[model samples]
Structure formats: C-alpha cells, structure tokens
Target: MPQLSVIVYGPNTQGHLTELLDSLDAHPLADAEVIVAAVGDWARETAGSHSPETIVVPLPDGTGDAAARAAGAARASGRWLHFVHAKDGLPAGAPRLIVERTAELDAMDTPGALAGPGAPDAPGAPVDVLLFDHVSTTWQTTAAPSGDGRLLAAVGRAGLPLDRSASLLRTAPLLGNRALRAAFWRAHEEEFTTDDEPYAACAALLRAGRVACLNQVAHEKRVLRPESLPPLAPEDRLALIDRYESLLALTEDRRAARTVLYDLMVRDLVRTFARENLPDPVAREFFHRASLAAVRWRPEGHQRPAGLEGVRHSLLEEGAYTRYRAFQAANRTRRAARKALRSRKRQVSVKVRDHQYRRALSRPVDPHLAVFTAYWDRGVACNPAAIAAKLAELAPHIRRVWVVSKENAALLPPGTDHVIPGTRRYWETLAGAKYLTNNVNFPGAVVKRPDTIHLQTHHGTPLKRMGLDQMDHPAAAQGLDFAALLARIDRWDYSVSANSHSTRMWERAYPARYTSLDHGYPRNDVFYTATAADVRAARARLGIAPGRTAVLYAPTHRDYEAGFTPRLDLAALADRLGENTVLLVRAHYFYGGAASPLTGLRRSGRIIDVSSYDPVEELCLAADALVTDYSSIMFDYANLDRPIVVYADDWETYRTTRGVYFDLMAEHPGKVAHSQEELTEIFLTGAWRDESAAKARAAFRRRFCEYDDGRAAERVVRRVFLGEPEEALPPVLPPEERTPAPTPEEATA
Candidate 1:
C-alpha cells in the first residue's frame, strides 16, 4: 500500500495544476500515489507525468469537486490521503508538518482541545484525520509571509464547510465506517460551498475516530482571479440553505445551533438572498422560511448590529407577502437625484465656463491665474501653494483663485477667492485662467488651450512603485483609469520633478512630451525655514500639551484591504506611551471613519486623529518623532531631522504584495519595530533616539535630500510660471560645499 495518496481536483483551473504537480515532483514524495480527479480528460492530460503511482478518475458531468473527492477517496490505495485543489500549490513544509502534527496527535490521549468528548485516542494510535491551514495569497500582494494563514471559523454556519485550502485524512478510518462515508457522500452531493469537503470530513471524523488538525500553513490559496466566486444561482442558494439547515438540526448546543441558523438567515436570507436574489417566488419563500427558523432559534449573538433588529422584526412578524414597494420607489428616486446632481452641477459649469471664457477674452492674459494641489479642492499645499505665494511676491498682477471641492472646502484657507470644483465660478476661472498650476492633473474633460500654461507638480517622492511601473498592477493603480490618466498628463505644459528619481519615474510613467523641471519639491520648503519657535507654535495650534512629545503615527495602506486596517490598538498604545506623549493618528488620505478610537475605547483626547488635517507639513512641524510603515512620508519626514520609528508588522505581506524599491526595515533612519509591543518598548525605553539612528538618518538625508533648500518654490515659479530658463534656478550644491567645513583638527580626529 502507498504511504500517502494525493487526490487533486481540477475545474476551470487550467494552468494552475501543472505547477502544483511540479512542486510535488521537486519535493521527494516517493511514498505517495497521485490521483487526478478530473472533470474531463484535459486536466489529467494537463498534469503530464508524475512519480509513485498515478490514476485518473473522470468525474460525472454537472458535479462539483465534492463528488470527485468522494469518488477519489473510495479508490485510493494509500493509508494516508491528502486532497488538494489543482488551483492551489502544496507548501514545501506541508508533508513534514503533516507527519509531526500526526505524531503529536498519535501521542495524545484525546485529540487537540477542539476534538471534544468520546474521542478515540489511545497513546501511539495512528492519526485518523489531519486538516491544515492555507496561506491566502492575492496577485496584488503576492509576497506576504506564509504563517498568517487562517482556517474556516468554527462559529458561522459557513465555517462548517471545509476550506479547499488543504485536507489530509486516513483512508481506513474514513472508508471503514458506512455511516460516516454516507454522511460525507450526501454532504458532497449537496454541492454547497467549496468547503463542503471539510464539512463532510468533519462529520466522518467525528463518528469514526479522533480528528486532529495542524493549524500550520501547508498550502497556498492564490486569488489570481479576484472574482472567482460568482453570484449564487437560486438553486445554489437553496443548496446552501439545505446544508445549513441540516447542520443546525445536528448541532446540539444553542450557540452552535444559533450560529448555523444565523449564517443561513442573516448572511443570506435578509442580506444577500433577499427579494433581489433570484426574485423567483420559490427562492424568496426559502429565504423567508430560513429567516423565521433563525429568529425562532435565537435573535441575538453573531456580532450583528443591534440596529438590524428592526429588519429582523419586520421579516419575522410581518409576512413575506408584505410588500415594501415604497422602499423600491424611494430608492429609485434617490438614485435618480444622485445621478442628476452631477448633471445639474455640470450645467452650472458650462454656464460659468462660458462666462469665465468670455470675461477672460476682454481681460489680458494675466499670468496671475488659478492654482490647485493634489485633488481639485485641496488647500494651499504642495507645489501650487508654494508657487502661488512666491508669484504674489514677485508679480502682484498674478490673481490666484483656489479651486476647492465642496466636501473638503473647510480645509481651504480663508481670505482667498476659492471656488468649489464643478461650481460655475470654478469652471469660469479654469476656462479663463492664463496659467494653471496643480500638483495633480486637471479634469481630462478640461480642454487645455494652446495659450494656457499647465504645470504638473506631483505630490511626493517614491520608494514604493508608482506611475507606469504600476500600469498593469491592480494593487498600485487601484481605481485609476490609465488611458484617462495619460490623457490628463498629456495636457500638462510643464512637469515638475523633485529629484532625478521622480523625474525618471514621471517621465516614463507619463509619456507626454511636457517639459521636465528637475527642481526639488516645493512642499519640503517648510522644513528648512521652520525655526524652533515655529515648531512650538505649530504644536500649540494643534493642541499638543507643552510637556508631551508629539508622536505622529502615520501608517501606509494595503492595496488588498478595502481601507485602513488598524494594526495598533490606540488605547493600548496610549497606555504604553504614558501621559508624557500625544499621538496624532494620521490615516492614509483614502480612508474615513467615526471619531472614536480604533480600539472602540471610550473617547479620550490622548490620541488625536489628524487624518483630516490636509497639511501634513504642519503635522511634521508639530511632531518631535515620526512612526510609520512603508509610507514615502518617512522619506519626507527625514528632512525634519527628528526621530523616526518604523512599525512594519505586515512587512513581508506588504513587500511580497506591493513590491517596494528598497528594504525599508533594513535601511530606515531610526528603530524598526516589527510589532506594536516593540514600537511601544522603543518609546517607553527611549531607544527611538539612539545616536546610531541619528547617523542613519544623516546618511538617508544625504541620499534622498539632494534637491530641497527652501528655494525650490522660487526655482519652480521662476522657470515654469515666470518663463525663465532652467539654469536660472540655482544648481544643486554638493554636501561638502553646502555645509560649513569642519575644523581641521576635528576633521582629522
């Protein structure tokens, strides 16, 4: 008999299986037998040749992997059987981990704690079953570490389904018991979730013998096609309901029973399987029945929002026949209103564009024009704000009208003629303006006439990938339309670059033939000119306590997650830092949330969320230290010459997924904290301010800080806005020439 039998299932996964078999071949699996449980002859042919013994089983048409798993297991000759999805690859450590964990289970009197009572285990007894975890991999973040794998939760009804991630079982224990095999075969035939195999395996293992699991990762579940789980058909939904209902009937405990029913009703019935899902009368009736069964079981737990009680009450008390037609009518009206809001705004824009266009025709081509930074409505910041201020000093004729977004209009500085974007005034000014300067591109719809001088002053330097490097990368170019992006870039008359790195990146990424102004970033000008008194004043303005050190905790975002996932517990961090520190929580610009602390701790003023504060430069001025992950903000913060603590908990995931230009943890200026505990320890121990870190910061500055000198704004205005030559801007001086020479004796020492 074979030592181990590997049964593989192949579906729409065409190119994935060959690599899986290749990996298995690379690793010596001499004692294993291979079985390709294929839908057709193609998957088996796709597998090519393999070692040990190989068998191909053609599954019945119109069936899922569950049926194939059952059929494959019946024919396997190996004592130990492992089931793998053709789309997933076995991790190198899986075979060894299976043995170690199996040995550990064999030595135990009972299986691991979750195995429960009546477990069949005598010391030295062979393992009946072993389930392992999967490392969830996505194309966006391909490099995440292996250990952060998760098994299906035991709480939700959906949790009962076995994850296609990985499964290993003892053939004899599974095949010996008729009832167990029947239970599995029935569950498999139901063909509900992908985890049906595990659900069935759990049923069989519970009856036949003790079940053991290695929560350790032994395979990769790559999410190459992000939308692989297609919408459930009405039959698919009914199948899921049947599976959950059966599981509910079997579950003896109230909590487990409630959980099973909750998943069926709450997860599907009222949520996904509403009247909208398969609007068929039969499907709707099943959803209602499931909802009624769930509410009768228990209305609470499952961490569902208490507010949803009204919804539950409506469904349970009011019959399914009750039509909330008013809801549909009202939603349609609201949707129409939302769609019309933009049309109404654009009508006003057209009127204003004409007015502004006509008004500018009478007026001379005033170099004094509109300036925007970042998005349309951002306040005076970045290159535009700096350039705008310098223009007023040099030529007072320059009329600077700021275009703001209505939502972010509050952040715009007062005493300026600011027009909300899409407003009549904004459209007029944009159309009429002689010179337009913005860090980001203007609307692609905006026709950049030959007379207009458009300056593209981008926001920051990059260590992570940017622009064209991310053209094909989903994670980097999330929500961006590349053709539209390039169209906007094509409108630019001058593209400002902070350094050679940015220049090269922007030039390649934005292939428009715009003139490149290789001057340093104007945003960093504040760092050079800000005195001690300025820092103190900025701190006072933001309400940082006099004695407390302002620590700016700004973390970079992950592409895979929807928004910011809070890695650090805010309350715990504050407690760790004590009363001597104040934390300014600066989330990435894309995220928004409630004013409450991330930990849901009752509102305390120790940690202030500065994510809304548009001017990060002001935060930098107020801060004594910077704490961040892989954000390019660290590179900017280094110019402040303050302490920097890099807290990169998901470094491996981020590096593997996002692909950074440099190893941040190894090269960062200050202490590199792998966890919140270490970051807190650094602050508590005051090791964030070591002399070595200071020296590292100096080196980092030498490498990245070649361009900035407070005169960057003047250089940009003089060249692009004022029509001066690039050489008119002062040349970037060498470090030795820029700084005062050290004393001869000190230098010699």
Candidate 2:
C-alpha cells in the first residue's frame, strides 16, 4: 500500500489547476499516490496530460466540491489520506517531510500513546490525525502565515490526546491542512457525510484517538478572488447552527472540548454576522437564530471574552436584535466623530500656512496649469519627467511646475519653473493645477479635487508586492494605513502600465476604478531613441574606458534591514573580474542621501557610485551587462537585450519577508548565481554572454518589452496632454523591428 493518498478536487474550469498540478510534478513524493477527482470533461482532459500513474476519477456534471472530495476519499487506498484543492499547491519538499513524519508515528510503540479512551492501542497503531501549517493567499494580498503555528508549537512533535490539546479546536475549522489515517477515517466515515468540511473536522477532533502537529507549512491555500466567490445562500449560512448543535452533543461528556467548540461556534457566527452583507430581513433572521444557539450552548460558569466582544455576547443572550443594531450604529458614529476631530486638529495646525492654498482650491481650476513630481520630490525624473518634456513640445500652452525639495532645487534645470514642498507656491500649484502627474503618491495632506486629472506613472515594473498586497508582510507594510492609501489611489484617473503583467498586478494591488493606459513606460523610450553617440557619451560621462566592459550592479532595498547594507563584497568581485571591467553600482532610492560604502573602490576607478544618478536610463545605456537582485531595473534593462545576472544570495529571506509576485530565479532573464563566487565564475568563464544567456534574455525581453518603442513618450503626450484618443496615438513597434541603443563596444567598433 502507498504511504499516502493525495486527493485533489476542484471545478473543471479552475484556471489555477495547471499551476497546482505543475507544482506537484516539480516536487514529487517517493511513495505517494495522487488521485484527481475530475469533476467535468475539462478536468479529465487536463488530468490526462499529467503523469499516467495519477488516478483520475471522473464525476458527473453539477457535482459539488464536497461530493468530489468524498468520491476521491472512497477510492483512496493508502494508509494515510491527504486532501488538496486544485487551486491550491503543496510547497517544495513538503510532501516528503509530511510522509517521513507520519512514517515515524507508524513505527513508534503503541504503549502510553495519547489515543483517547476505547482506542485500539496494539503495536504499530495509526495516529488519528496529523495537523500541519498552511498559508493563505488572495488576489489583493500576499501569503499570510497561519495563526495555528503558536498552538501547534506548544503541542510539540509528540502525539497527544484530543482532550490534552483541546485548544487545537481553533484550527479545526480548516480541512486541507491535516491528514488522517485511513483506518481512523474509515471508523468515523459516517461523521463526514455532511457537505461542510468544518463540521466534519470538528466531529473528527471530538472523536480522534491520537493527534500530532507538524509545525511546517505543508499547504498553500489560494483564496478565490472576491468576484469569483459565490455568494453564500441564506440556508447555507443558517446551517452552521445545526452543525454546531451536532458538535455540542458529540462533546457533551468532554468538558474542555465542549467549551472550546462552543467558543469556536460563537466566534464563527459573529464573524459571519459582522462581515457578510445580508438583506435586513435575512440579517434579522440570522441574528435571531444565532442568539438562540448562543443561549442554548452557553457552557456553565463560562467567562465571556472581554471588551466589545463580551458586550456582544451579553446582547445576544438577551435576544435583543434591535438593541444590537443600535449599538453598532452608535459605535460607528463615535468612530466617525473621532476621525473628524483629528482632521479638524490637523487643519488648525496648518491653517495659517495653507490659507492661500485653500483660497486656490475654492477658485476654478486653471485649465492650462499642470503639476508633476517624481520619487517624492527628489527631482524631475522617471516617467513623469519624460511626459513633462513631451508636454513642452506637444502642448506649449500648458504651464508645468515641478514639485522639488529644497535640497534638490539646485538639481533642476536653471530655467525650469519649480516649487519647494511645504511652501505657499507648492500648495497653490497643487490646488490650482488641472492636471497632476507623479511617479509616487503626493502627501496625504493634499486634497484631490474632482476636476483635477491625476496620472500615476509608476516608476518600474513590480517584482515585489506593492499597495494592498503588502498587508501580509509586516516588514514591508511598516504600519501603512491601507485606508489612506486607497483614498490616494482613488484620485488617480489614469495609471500607466508598461506591460500586461504590470497592468494585472496594478489592478489587483490598487483596486481602484482608474483606467490603465497600457502605453509602455515613457522613461524606457530612450532605449530605442538614443543614438550610438548617446551610448558612448553616457559611457564617457560615467568614466568607463573605451573597449572596457561596464556592468551595472543595482540591488533593491531590504525591508527587514534598518539601512542600506551591501550584499556583495564589491572590491573582491571587481578584483576577480580583472581591471578590464568596471562596476556601476546603484543603490536603491530608499537610501538616496547616505554616504557611499564603496568610496575606496570608487577612488580605485573600479566602482562608480550612481546611487543618486538621475535618469537611470543613462546607466542602462552605458552598461554592457546588468547584475541585479530583485530590482525592477532588470525589466527595463531587458529592453537593451543585454546579458542579465541575478545575484540572489538571500533570495529565500527576501521572498519570505517581502513577498514577490513570481519566482525570479525560475524565470530569470539570464543566469542566476546564489553566491559571490558563482557570480565571479560566470563573468570569468564567458558564460554571461553565452547562447543560453541570449535565449533567456530574448524570452524575458519578449514578455517585458512588449510595448516599449521609440514613441512611448509621444503616445503619452498625445493621449494625456493633447487629449487625443488611444486609436490616434502611435502604435507600438514589435521587438524585432525596434532597435535598441548601441553598446560602447558596438559604437567603438
């Protein structure tokens, strides 16, 4: 018999099924059977393409997920049964880890086992259940680690009686994160007849002989997109009351288990009541039904949880639905009043300085006035700068004023009109401008008028999670107020996207009603427009000697670290690459003003610090190759068709702390090196410019450089500044037809 039977089930049309199956193939188990419960013709067809050893069980049309799961379970023949949904996945090496842990349990002596009373405890007895950790991911959020870790950590690796670890009942709500012994499952098969997995999980926990916790994340649960989820019927929501009653009867004799189960039921009902938007009649009905269950299942001498929750329990026990509604309304009113008071205080604090700005806001917006900023007022650069320059030639009547910080004021062109942040001119310009463009968000204090057009020309293609997606990574979120962020995003009338991938990510992350202008990044237009002379001039400006190789080393910031910390020893790397090569090091903009740590190497003429360099387009034009780790610069550099290397020494750490949209190592532009030694070897061995590297770079360019052509800036200026239709704008040139700027070597040749 196989050690484990993995039963997978989902709707036939589920789009993520292929990803799930592919992950399983990449990380296969040695002694496990896979049973795919194909629910329709499409599912069967897709399953046929997978390994022939996988068992495909066809189900009739219109079958629900629960019935499919039951069918798969009935066909399962292994000693252990594990369930998986087609939209979910198994993490790498998780299957082997799970199988090994369960095998150990089977080999242990049965004496003194924590199996519950009446359990058969002969030698080689099977464990009732083995629980493991999981991650939950949604379209608008990154993967969030399960809270079950703390409870499971306390239970240790040893098997324990259900009563000894009754608190594990909190996690009994999820199904796919646990495995059950086939023998144990057969004994309690009748209890799982219901369609509700939570109810069945509760039943199994109440009756389990012995349970163990696997403290590793073995499953990846994909939360269906909000629009994809079907609304819960009134009957389905009400059925929870019946499930909880049945569970209460099962746990009647077990006091600790009964208390935990009761608390779980009440919490579940409260969450549904608070989160779901039901009609008034249905909501009242649900509240009435829930109040009765709360009163009936109240454990003796039970202490209600503290704060607003305890108050809610008291109201529920009284069966006062009207009073509960009133209480919720009053609380909302109090919160709104407090928020308004805070706003009023802020206004008072800035009233004197902002008086002229307030006056400007009341007046009609100036149709010819426009405002632009980039990198939080660093200087005029990026897509905003490109658009601003084009606007000057295309719509000369429109007055453009840039927002710059006092320190960066000198960096702007001598004749350029600009306003310093926090000054009266800055406030008036922001208030009066009918068109505003920025690469980053303006300060939260700035008011967005309805008549003003806001264009968000994001600086780069997203590799790391952004906007609402950062909610799960606390290090990345850094106490961000999502509500405020959304308010700012709401002001955007247009969001510029570089490619389809970026368009999808931005839509999901920001989730505003703004229209996406899929006209490639304007800043990257330089790649196609620059002449051979331009490339040589960029190289000369950066002090790259003729006939020498220049490698641009740009690394992204780490949210887990306090400040800039170089991951590579630049001196050692430059020495190894020989004096024929020069490194153009650019740190992330987050550490813009910090002193360079590579000053010694810069003095040696081996390293040039371009951390504060304007128009990174110039840096890309000067380099022969690009070396980066998780920086969006790779996406832009691919346009040049240069050899790109990913130096990811701390890839796992970065992926965990600051979640990424995709695995860069798997679909890299060129070669990937995990260590400094490997990186040096790649350059020395001429592998960086090999045929394999060219193929990777070609594929990467096709995907990312889809819309970038010489005319991107013209397209933006025509569509946005000139008020022309998208059809009238210039069409994008295909990659093969477009010519990127020549390298210094090609220019010199």
Candidate 3:
C-alpha cells in the first residue's frame, strides 16, 4: 500500500495529472503508491492512462466538490493522507517530505501524534516549510522543525496563513501520542471538504491538530481573470455580514462586528444604486424610499470587535439618517429634472367616453396565471426555448403571454397572435394579461394590478443584486428607492430571478409573494440539446464558414455612471486568433442599443459583432470558444462543452462597485485574463495546452452547470405547461452534511 494516499478531485487537471505522474515517477520513494478519486470518467481515464498501478476511486456525479473530498477519504487505504485539487501541484519533493515526516513520527519513542512539517517551528528550532504559493501554482514542501503546540493554536485563532499549504502528517502517534492517525482522522473526517475559500477556512479552523504553516511560497496562486476576483456575490454580502457578526460573537467583541457591518452595509447600498441603469424618474424615487427605510431600521446591537471601532464611529459621526436625507434631496432634484422633461414630451390627448356597457358585457375568463420572466440587460435578452416550452404547455388553455420591457413594442412569441405591449401603454397591455409572468421582479407590472395573478420565471440564475435592492439597505437611504421609483420599475414587468443564494432576497425585496424554481434561462435550453450536431451543421449552412471554430467574446456595459468607458481593443483580439477560429463579440444588450465598440472586430476578417444575434441561436451554432467578464453567459456556456475564457480587466473595481454572486477565481473553470496579452495567450494557447485548463473546466461545469441531458426544455414544458409540481429534479446541495445555522427568530425565541 502507498504510504500517502493522494486524493485528487476535478477533471480539468487531468492533463496536469499526466504531467504530475511523470514528475512523481522519478521520485526516490519508488515504493510509495498513488490513489486518485476522480470526479468523472474523463478524470479516471486520464489518471489510469498515466499510472495504471494507481488506485482510482470514482466519485459520484452531483456530489459537489466538498462531498468528493470526503468520498476520497472514505475510500483511501494509505496510513497518511494528502488531499488537494487536480489544479494544485505538489512541490518537487512533496512525497519525500511527507515520507520523511511519517518516518520521523515512526522513529520517535513517543512523538507528537499530529506533527506536520510546515507549521511554525518551536521557539528554538527552524520550521521546515512544506507549502509554497506562487502567482499560479501551489507546491507542498517539507522543511519545518518541531513547534510549541500553543503557538499553533494561537495562529489558527488569528486566521493567519489563509491558504492551506501542503501539510504532512504522521500515520501514527509518536512522542506521547494520544491515538493513531486513523483514529484521529475518524474523529475529524466530517469536518474536511473543498468548498471554495470561506468553506475551506471554516473546515481548516474547525479541525486539525498541531497545525503548521510553511511560510515558503510552495503554492503558486494563479492570477485569475479580472472578472474572477473579489469572489463574494451580492447575496454573499449579507452572509459575510453574518459571518463577521459570528466572528465577533465568538470573541464576544461588539465593536468589531459593528464596524464591519456598517462598512459593508453602506458599500452595498451605494453599489445597488450605482450599478443600475434606472431611468431618471425611477432612480429618484428609489433613492427617496431607500433613505426613508434607512431612517426607520437603525441597526442597534450587533457585536463589534475593538480595533475596528473606526467604522462604527464614522457611521455615528457621519449621521446615518443625515446621509439618507442627502440622498432624498438628490433624488428630489432628479425628479424635478424628469418632470421638466415630461412636460416637454407630454401631448394633450382627448379622453374617450367610458363604455361601461360594452366592458361589462365582455366574456368571463378561466383561471388566470401571470408569468413574469425578468432578465439582466446582457446575455441573450430572452430564453426562447423557455418561452416555447411555456407556450407549448399553456397555449391552448392559457390566455396570453405579456412580454414587458422598459420600451414598448408589439413583439409576441412565434406562433402566438396574443400580442401586448408594456411601455407607456402598460395598463392597456396588462388589462389583457390576466395571468402575469416575468423573468425578474418589475414591481410596476403587478403592484397596482390586483386582479391579475402573477408568476415569475426569472430569466437567469442568481449572481448579484440590481437597482436599489438589498435587505440591509435602509428604505430611506436606498440609492434607487423602489417605492418612489415604483412607476419606473413597473414599466417593465413583474418577477425576479433567484437561485439558492439569493432566494431570500426575492421574498424580502418584493411585497408580493415570490416563487422560485431550479430551471435556468428558457433560452439556455438551446445549449442543452440533442441537436448539437444539427446546430453545428446549421451554422455551416449559414454564412459561418466550415472548418472555423467559433469564439464568443461578450462583455457587460459600464453604464458610464461607474465613471468608466465601455471599450475593448477588438483589433488586438482578432489578431491573436488562429486562422480557423472566428470571434463573435456580443456587447451588453444596452450597449447594443447604443454606439458599439465592436466596429474594429467586425472590420477584421474573422471577428463579427453578434449584438443583434439572439445569444441562444448564436451559441447553438456559433461557438467553440467563449470569452466574457461578469456577464451570465458563462452559466449558459457551460451547457456546451466549448472552452471559456474570462476577460475581466475590471474585476476588482466591479466587485467593489456591483459585487458578485460567487468567487470566479476559485469557482470558474477557465482562463482569466487581466490584460490584453494575457487574454490573447489564454484564448490562443493556455486553454488547451496548459494542463491546468482541464481542471478549470471541470470546476466550471460542476459549479455553474451540470446534468444537462439536452432535455431541459422538455422538463420545463412538463412542469410549467402541464402544471406539474417541481419534483422532477432533486434539490442541489453538496453531499456533505451541513450544520444549519439558527435563524434570527429561532435565536431570539
């Protein structure tokens, strides 16, 4: 049996695994064996081809990253364990280091049962470094001396050495050992997992005995794409606030929690309003209502740690209520400007006599259902498959489908003649849509129309908040006050999109009852298709030439309110593509309605602006490569097997400005580029040639999309059109048993 059971997860790094096997094959400890717990058949195949002697454990699909780690542990036979991802590489001499530590533990008359090589050294001796991190890789080293136990505990408490360096452990207890390594593991195995950074932090802190930090740069932490940084999502903002509160409570420190909470709350409020492309009328009203809400819900007693008093003090000194008043004043000015503009556009129209007799004589209707599908102004504007699926289900029985928008149009679904508009003629259009459904929440659609029943099929997955929207933001201080701005929002539709992360926000933000489902964009059904070959052939039939692989580079709009110009050097990008590869640049939907930055790309021989093309249609027949930053295209792209590259040059600023749904760097399985050169390299060479690319793809698929059997549209048709209950799919959860935290009510009670 192998001395160390190296359990690896993720398929993206299968190529890296091949390289790793070649590197490890030359190790001096030829006696040691390797065990790989792979996520898929691809991973297993990759590992098997390199080291057939290696024991391979196939992890269950849909078990999630954390569960895969636990499963690997359950199956390992080695006395010592080394758990990591395929993307992570061991230092040149990691095996020797682990073996040496195990040997040392074996040699001592009574060794410390849990001695790791890289932890801080004892006061007298030097600490052998085990883990070293670089710009893009991680290495496990073996060069730390023994350390005092108390020091280890202190460092753990302080949250020092945030990264988990490659750690070496003793298989058995040594100096005055309490229990064998197996026994120790059995007691703590439940605590181990691989759920991004925060979860990793929680697991590392909760378990482990006599932990050590090898300060050496054994690990090379790669620079992710600009869109991948500041991984916390809009929904995560609330959770992070709760986390800080928990940390403060653990330490019994009120000041610290208060400070962190205050800063996050203020920043969230600012970001919510700053990021929205609200009409002046809506923006003003939203600001007013938010200001009022802030004044009403004054945060009182959340604990705060001491050194962080400055945050709380600033809030007090600045006068939270006063800030809200200032917001209100600004919105008042905006409202005045909007009113003046309306006066100029207002046209006198004759009021028609009320035909009460004719209206009252109208035919009575059947049971009504309103569907609202809300979407961000990026990606494919509409999910046609979802719409078709819905239409297929409800066409004969359902009355009509009302497509709401900020601007009015007489657009209707194909094959349907029941067309309605929602711009300035919202009431007239809505009068016919008895059953209201929208992609996301547009309060304007349902707030006043009490007779219509509303059902929301949110356009995409939850990733961030929009407008002046957040539970933490005060109503009065709200930058985009929904109440005051109700008219503006109501102009579009009624509904909001949500996933597990932002589920609560849906209910909290809207006064009306909200519903959620597991289905993704109605349009994304194109990517999840049995007709992939057909789609490819369809593109061939179109002007898209044969033998040319397609690449879609889609980026979001800047709003210009964020004080940044929306620009991309398309010429530079086009110059980098291979002869057979074509680049499709999809600008943000809003940007598409304005001056486009894709002229340069369009001028190039292979690059084309897909701004006017429906994304689902384009994605179906047009892409072999995908490049995006902060847009939801990644989620849909995962349904296809094409490579994705994130060109997020403004990731850090965007996170600070609008926040994110998750950590892109840790979760996204693609090449991230911060510069044009990096973007070109990622698109041209790194995507396929780099061993780590495969692991990245695996991570992306697992997190953003899975179980795409090309029947997603069929599933939706069954559920929505047939009025089936949402039991067709299982709830998505990691395999690990998570301990649920207490709700506010439960804690108070």
Lowest lDDT sum, 10 consecutive residues, model 1, at 172-181
Superposed by TM-score, candidate 3 places the C-alpha of residue 616 at a distance from the truth, in angstroms, of 3.7
Superposition error at 65 for model 3 (Å): 60
How many backbone clashes does every candidate have? 13, 1, 93
Q: Which lDDT tens digits does candidate 1 get at residues 167-273?
A: 22222112211111122233333432345543454345432333444444455565576365565566655665555555445444434434534444455455444
Of 1 and 2, the candidate ahead on lDDT is 2
Backbone clash pairs in model 3 (N, Cα, C under 3 Å; residues 3+ apart or in different chains), count: 93
User: How would you order the candidates by TM-score, starting with the best?
Assistant: 1, 2, 3
* Superposition TM-score, candidate 3 onto the true structure: 0.45
lDDT of 2 by residue, 610-679 (tens): 8877679999999999999999999999988889999998899999999999988888999999877789
Candidate of highest lDDT: 2
After superposition on all CA atoms, what RMSD does each candidate show versus the true structure?
Answer: 12.5, 14.5, 24.2
**lDDT rank order:** 2, 1, 3
**Candidate 2 has what TM-score?**
0.55
Model 2 worst lDDT window (10 residues): 115-124
